[model samples]
Target: MGRKEEEFGYLLDNNAANTEVHTKTGSTDQCSQHSSTETHKSLESTYLGSDDDEVRRSQAGQSCDYGEEEGHLVYHIGLLLEERYEVVSTLGAGAFGKVVECFDRDKGLRAAVKIVRKFESFREVAKSEITVLKEINMLDDDNRFACVRMLEWFEHQGHVCMVFELLGLSTYEVLCQTDFLPYSVDQIRDMAFQIFKAVSFLHRNKLTHTDLKPENILFVCSDYNLEYNNDTKRDERRMRSLDVKVVDFGTATFDHEHHQSLVSTRHYRAPEIILDLGWNQSCDVWSLACVLMEYYLGQTLFPTHDSKEHLAMMEKIIGPIPPHLLKLTSKQHYVHNQRLDFDESSPSGEYVRKHCKPLKHLQRKSEGERQLFDLLGCMLEYDVSRRITLEEALWHPFFSPMRTQKKKRS
Candidate 1:
């Protein structure tokens, strides 16, 4: 590698997460020698605005063109940010903007800097995210929860820049790497425990994550190995660290805040959200159910993007939406004659039938599987009132072994 590239810090793949690799780029004398590294195969979260009204981002080079190529600030390689973080490479990009990996000379670590679009709407979203992150950072000062930590923030060339501790791949990316094989019940249990603890902390603080899909949940370290499975006769990759954090707080809402009629990603969305029935923390639980189910099956339980077909999939898997819920829905077109406007003879109806089955039928006949499905049933309850909260879910039999471990430790 050329000296220039080395000075820019080691550039890895688009998604590889790195850490502690501090290299001195001639611009600064603060940087130390290179240290260690890790892999983050992907980043799927979006960050959106401003910490202050005065610290305006740069206006010339780019909002990623400053406005020429949409709102992204044109990423100039090796550009110095806040005089402390030097941009190395683009790690990922999304609707919000882009995230650049930078070498933090002050801390001797690699950081993921989220660059948000300068558009007013995007900026407002970014501002809201900053508020939520600030509250979370204050509440969890010791970092006990499994949440992505925001180390700092700044404005540069008209873009809101959020600096976070570097993390690895999204759970979805890891699932894809494993060739879509189902995660063992034990693996799911461990992952789910950490997820629940993190989410439960949010609920206790009166906040709802609103978005909880596998793609939004990320591993802290994606380092892994390929192990030959004698039974499956396939080389399966096992993650070295199951530790994960829920990301993308751009959509998280507090209880007293106005609830958007629609929230969460299509497949992970709750019935209450789809029906426009007003929701709360229970909606997050429902989304977690979908995420856990995906981990168990190695694929999305409800793969459809269409809201109507998604409802059909849910009905097929969990049973009919309660009459009260259907009766209360403002989206009247979705119902006819007091039933989902689904015709058993229609092509779409057949498609739903071909793809879905009762949740009980989808699970293997093992005690652990049964227990997981049982907890899922509680979480998937159509009535938000009846749906299980993350607190209650932690005590469910599926997590009994985990609770036992905790008890032994205490």
Candidate 2:
């Protein structure tokens, strides 16, 4: 069976059991994994952010002129920005903007330039995104999280440009080509550590990535070539590495003192978000768990057809709530229609009994997979307060095997 089928089957078989599954037959946590070197180069560049709110508003008079070109206007870096960089090619395109190829004029190096239009309030949003990028860049400099490195930010012809380090293929591309390679215990452990470190850093800074998925994770070619067998194409090998640096902060929010906006991909969103419960950084933690699970299992843990069914699936896994967390729920309609009453033992037991049957199959899976299942289960707990903390997760036995292996090797 495929990884998704295996995961679903496991979940259905072992809803209540606490036993751990074994790893791959021949897999050992002591297996040698590839490592990489970090190189840094400095170049003279100008940085800008919102200096004056009033000045920003006044300058916002400029608007995106979509009518300027019949087809999309391809702006070459050397031609448009009068920089020494050569516009190499297009990296990727998106709704908000397109990342294009560029070679640094003075430094003689390759970089990706993200071009965004000038919207009325978009400048403020861009400024906010830049601020987040700067913070992330600083953190990455010291710890070296797997994330796209920000080179610089600038304005050209009423549009904002963000320069970033060029990396290999995205995880989405890799999964599509290889049909989602079965990650060995060591590979999964390494990827999980990188993801946890990234999310933990964001949480420490009171920042929520808001979006977490395979598509955002970019691979470095050397890493992929080392991990997987077979000499694949540059693009194919790039997909294999699946080394992701979280990108796209347009929907991210800061200032943990208050909730800003409801933002996140539906598949990765937490139950609190779907139920409109007052959410916090924990929501991002939940999403991270979903992404990590998807990577290992090759499909979403809570795959559903629609929002209603999705919510129901989550409710089933997490069980009923406590009075304290229920009071914090924001969606009155959802609470009225979907909320379960666990006040009584029999009714709540019945609820748990009914939902518990579907998860029995999870017991048959391997130990690494079971650990992931349990970790996801904890993250997906209905009561947000009862959810797993990042610190707690760091010390999980799921990670212990790898740590043990690392110590043995050392």
RMSD of each: 10.8, 12.8
Count of clashes, each model: 17, 21
* Candidate 2 lDDT over residue span 1-410, tens digit each: 44322211111100010111111111121011000010100000011221112222333433333224322335753554546546776554332345566878778787767666445366566777788888888877874676556888888777778887776544434443354554455566677777777777777888876666554555555234424445432222222453556565654567554454444555576777766666787887788776775555444455432344455555555555544555666655444533543332554344334433344353336777678767777776667678897767877888987678669999
185-235 per-residue lDDT for model 1 (tens digits): 887999999999999999999999887877677788877888888975866
lDDT of each: 0.72, 0.53
True-structure lDDT of candidate 1: 0.72
Candidate 2 local lDDT, residue 262: 47
Worst 10 residues of 1 by lDDT: 27-36
Model 1 CA RMSD to the hidden true structure, in angstroms: 10.8
Model 2 Cα RMSD, Å? 12.8
